[model samples]
Target: MILRLTLAAIAFAATLAAPLRAEIAIQEVTSPGGIKAWLVEDHNIPFMALEIRFRGGTSLDQPGKRGAVNLMTATLEEGAGDLDAQGFAAARDGLAARIGFGANSDEVSISVQALSENRAEAMDLLRLALTEPRFDAEAVERVKGQILAGLRADERDPSAIAARLARARSYGDHPYGSAGDGTTDSVTALTRDDVLAAWQGAMARDRVYVAAAGDITADELGLLLDKLLSDLPETGWPLPPPATLNTAGGLFVEPFPGPQSVVLFGHGGIAFDDPDFFAASLLNDILGGGRFSARLMSEVRDKRGLTYGIGTGLSVRDLSAEWMGQFQASNDKVAEAITVVRAEWARMAAGEITETDLATAKTYMTGAYPLRFDGNDAIANILVGMQMLGLPSDYPKTRNDKVNAVTLDDLKRVAARLLKPDDLFFTVVGQPEGLTSSE
Candidate 1:
């Protein structure tokens, strides 16, 4: 009776403390020129931040024009309107504003941060960067050299080699198989014309997503957005179709001169729109997604002491989605590590989750979920991403409930469908002792 009373007192204290945390406010804005954006205002700070993303990412690269979009993003800041690279730098410093641009596998992003006192001038500078970019050749080459250096450096890292080989084996002949940062061969061959054409083809108003946070009113943001997106052409290029998932059986080894082997293996998984997505996320949490209280950690760390860490998740992109799991262990334990992974895969495939396991997973997933909305920038970013993925406005409010609703039967079904040990693609990098393709 005393222990029950103590537990009740602790629960009461937690309930009382929960209300002290602030909730994020989400507001949608549509510009006069029809550009829509999500906004979150935080008056606590004296500065504002704007983040915008476009749809045509690395997946949209044409055959021989690889890395063109990345080059465009890099060069856009070099010159714009009447300002060359040096002139633009002077202008930015004059207003004490910061701006940057980059592209990823699924989207290209532009971000700016400025003081509230100089919001208008800062925004105009952003407008010039966005709508009047010059795409200078020298700037393009400079960025290309930086990328080449990274590619060279990555070759020496066993983890990087393992990841690259895994994708190549999993998505053969598909654009999604290629690296977001183009290969050394492809990037070295790119020209100025290719960069310009890719910019004109990919960066369009129709494919844009905007997000802002800080000391700005709705009216100010509306006007700023109009000025920034005004020069975009009316139509955009059609987005390429989604990537295909290849589950054919294959294993490859990239023998790196290292003592450890970085092993990566998984198969096709569900899309974001799948009703089973929330359930699948919870299932992954139980298996290997969580840092603690996961099957992989228990088996690989606590029992065998093989590796220090393991991870699993859905690798979601605009063109494709896949279930991926990874681990690293010493060369001597590589075979043992692979065996544990396969056993866990088979165990999940056979639907063996216990009541205790399910309950623990649910608590980990739901209890920590609210932390994602702790700040204005995080909230704005989440809203913008959800809009791009076609998720509902109420997604954040209902996400935990959906996760809580996933059952043992749901996990069984998703696991059986997604976990394909027979068809998995394996890539092990480093000089693992006594390791073979068969293992």
Candidate 2:
């Protein structure tokens, strides 16, 4: 309990990181056994954060085991090797290490933090969890119960309803269309073997990426890497085929009891590797990238009072990408809010951006980028994310220049090509007034 409370307190401190703009020197280290990781040396602190990610997360679940990967990830900390749940917690807390595991559609992540003095022991503990997880029946059932409860609760959540419908309408038969948690039926039926399958399918060396920051040398990181992961299978299940998106525009209303409606909207989006991505990013900021100065917020909330908030983003996934947004409003106002959103989309698609809009977006994006590197954990996470995205290691240094080089004309040209006002689809969940399902 004491260590858990200490971790909870550390979370509050982590979030309070000042928006500092510091230069980061990143080095690529390859382990003796050929494992590669990105490292940032910060000797001022006697602590470190390490992040590891594996591609093909829950999407690797076998045909009949939709939620196996997610379930396995949750149960990783429950027990491993000779340790029971309580024993594992006691060992980790004794070393003052905080480790976490998580999964989504595209990737599974492991995060760890430990003081320099106990880094080796902490990593060894993690090694046991990764390579020899007990997956005891009791542990599996407990985590399964928690996931089942969440699935049941999602049945009535308007946001979840809109999200489910949106993905179904967008991705069709692909794995992206369904929930990562699977259905309550599928989860309840999962067995210990299914969880083991998920572990093998998702946690292999072939698809893993690693990064570390603070109080560790490149040589030390390299040696540690091989000790931590050399035993995993070299390969696992094949990745699923790409998702074929339905970009056709229309409104789909799900009837749920509520005075207000939740809506998700978007269409096809640009990919990270696209040459015009920087332009699309600046354009997204000007449109509805969640800032109060965004056009959607200004039109839908400030001027017309149709909704409390509305924003859009470039939602890129392993197999597909889409430009998406969400907002909530009174049932009577949902239609109006969407109308205003459509108008703004059309206006932007028509290349109607002003120089002032471009300047403001560039400044805000550039300034906010540095705030992401406030601590060792944040920097390590960024390093792994950049690797996963296939970005160049020097991206941090060149990123601002790319944003600054985007001229007003660049956004206008990219907006015209990227935004299809007519292709934007809306998924609304609730008794939205004046809204009827599209044919």
lDDT against the true structure, per candidate, is 0.77, 0.91
Q: State each model's C-alpha RMSD to the native.
A: 8.0, 1.8
- Candidate 2's displacement at residue 415, Å, is 0.7
lDDT of 2 at 395: 92
Q: Give TM-scores for every candidate, taking all chains together and pairing residue i with residue i.
A: 0.90, 0.97
Instruction: Give one digit per residue, the lDDT tens place, for model 1 in 300-391.
Output: 88899999988889888777888888888898998888878888888988888887888888887788878666444455566778888997
- Model 1: number of clashes? 0
- Local accuracy of candidate 2 as per-residue lDDT tens digits, 1-439: 7655665555445445423663679999999999999998877666789999999998888887889999999999998999999999999999889999999999999999987877898999999999999999999999999999999999989999889899888888688988999999999999999999899889999999999987899999999999999999999889899889998999999999979999999999988999899999989999998689999999999999998888899988989989999999999999989999999999999999999999999999999998888888999999999999998889998999998999988888899899999999999999999999995
Model 2 misplaced regions, further than 4 Å:
1-19
97: Cα error in model 2, Å: 0.6
> Which 10-residue window in model 2 sums to the lowest lDDT?
10-19
Return the number of clashes found in candidate 2.
Answer: 0
